[model samples]
Target chain A: QQPVQSPQAVILREGEDAVINCSSSKALYSVHWYRQKHGEAPIFLMILLKGGEQKGHDKISASFNEKKQQSSLYLTASQLSYSGTYFCGPKRGGADGLTFGKGTHLIIQP
Target chain B: EADIYQTPRYLVIGTGKKITLECSQTMGHDKMYWYQQDPGMELHLIHYSYGVNSTEKGDLSSESTVSRIRTEHFPLTLESARPSHTSQYLCASSGSTSGKETQYFGPGTRLLVL
Candidate 1:
């Protein structure tokens, strides 16, 4: 089943912070985060494995809670370049095909 | 910086036309996948391959078929395209590394069946 993403869409001002949450009914093995600009491919942002591991990028971070079967991506000091659709995909067991959420539309205003 | 590529960035064709979407990756990834995405919507996995000669259907039932004759190439073919088949086809590849199966994507082919 596809994971659920919160805040279907969000508008943010530059330098503001936003959080996107993804939860799945099934247990998760790893969570993958990707960002896609208009008419472009989804770019890999980060991947959070099980064991409650957290990964971060420049002002972009993500956390995975294995027990909760959920993941959260944090966009700190959001920039205009951060404007895009964010997708969270959680992998369960040996499944190679990832089921992506509907995606969280993030708009950052200058 | 992943070297995945897709051909025919955009295609507009009439219904009943046969088409093939090509995807190739130079990163030597063991796994490759094809995902169909509608504009501003979630992606649905159509097909995937673990390596050359190993193709499998994805969670979403797709009418298109895929082939993995070479490790770096996975192509999708539609014998007879329909309007319902119009969608963005995204190709992605990932290495076999455990706990680090981060997939890198191609620019994608936006297909339009008239």
Candidate 2:
């Protein structure tokens, strides 16, 4: 099943911070994040495995809480370049095929 | 950036036309997938492949079919296109390391079935 994402859309100013959340009804073994700009393909951000670990990429980072079956993407000091839709792909178990969420629309204005 | 590439970045065809969406990856990843999505919407997995000669349908019911005849290539075909088939088709390949799998996606093909 597809995970649920919160704050379907958010607007932030440059240098501001924002958080997007993804939660699944089933337990998730791994969570992957991607960002897609208008008219472009989704780009890999980071992946967090069960261990309840936090992974970071540049100013963006994510935390995976296997216990809660949820993952949160944190964007700090957001830049205009960060304006795009963020999707969380959580896999319960088995293969690498991920069930993606509806996505969080983030807009960063200068 | 991902080495995956897709052809016919944008297509506009009439109904009952046959079209093939080509996907190729130079990374030599054995796992590939196809996802369908509408504008500003969620992604739906339509098909996937483990390796050559191994293809499987995904959660979403798709009228399209896919073939994995080579490690680096997986193509999706739609024998007859309709307005409902108009959407963005994304191709992805995943590589595993240390028990973690990350998918690399192509730019995607925007299909407009008129």
Candidate 3:
């Protein structure tokens, strides 16, 4: 099943911060975060595992709560380039593909 | 950067015509997936493959079919395209790195049926 993302859309001033949340109804083995710019492919931001281990990305960070089947993505000092639609994918360990949330559209303006 | 690629970044075809969307990855990852998404909508998984010759339908019931005959290629086909089938098709692949896997996506193909 697909995860649910909060704050369907948000507008932020440059240098501001924002948080995007992803909640799943089913237990999750891992939660993945991705960002897709308009007319571009979705890029992998990071993956948070069941044991609370986080992997990937340089500027952005995320936290995974396996117990609650939720994950939150943190973007600090957001830049204009950070504007895009963010998606959270809750995954179960298997050959099946990750289930992506509806997505959060973030817009950063000067 | 991810080496995955999708051809015909945009396609406009007539109804009832068959079309194949090409997806290829140079990373040689064992896991590949195909997703369809309408503008401003969530990405829906149409198909996925763990390895060569292993193909499975995803949660979304799609009229499309996919084949994974080669490790580097996974293509999706629609036997008879319709207006309802118009959407952006994205291809992605994931590889394990120290027990964690990161998926890399292609540019995506935007298809329009007239």
Q: What is the TM-score of chain A alone in each candidate?
A: 0.97, 0.97, 0.93
Better of 1 and 3 by DockQ: 3
| Model 3 spans with C-alpha error above 4 angstroms | A54-58
Which pairs of residues clash in candidate 2, taking residues 3 or more apart in a chain or in different chains?
Answer: none
Per-residue CA lDDT of model 1 for B1-114, tens digit only, reads: 899999989999999999999999999988999999999998888898888899999889999999999999999999999999999999999985765888899999999999
Candidate number of the best DockQ? 3
Candidate 3 has which clashing residue pairs, if any? none
Q: How far is candidate 2 from the true structure (C-alpha RMSD, Å)?
A: 0.9
Clashes of each: 0, 0, 0
lDDT leaderboard ranking: 2, 1, 3
DockQ list for all candidates: 0.79, 0.77, 0.82
lDDT of 2 by residue, A27-92 (tens): 888999999998889988999997889999889999999999999999999999999999999987
CAPRI-wise, candidate 3 is high
Q: For each candidate, what TM-score against the reference?
A: 0.97, 0.97, 0.96
- Among all windows of 10 consecutive residues in model 2 chain A, the one with the lowest summed lDDT is A91-100
Answer with 1 or 2, whichever has the higher DockQ: 1
Candidate 1 Cα misplacement greater than 4 A, ranges: none
Error of 3 at A18 (Å): 0.8
At residue A7, give the lDDT of candidate 2.
83
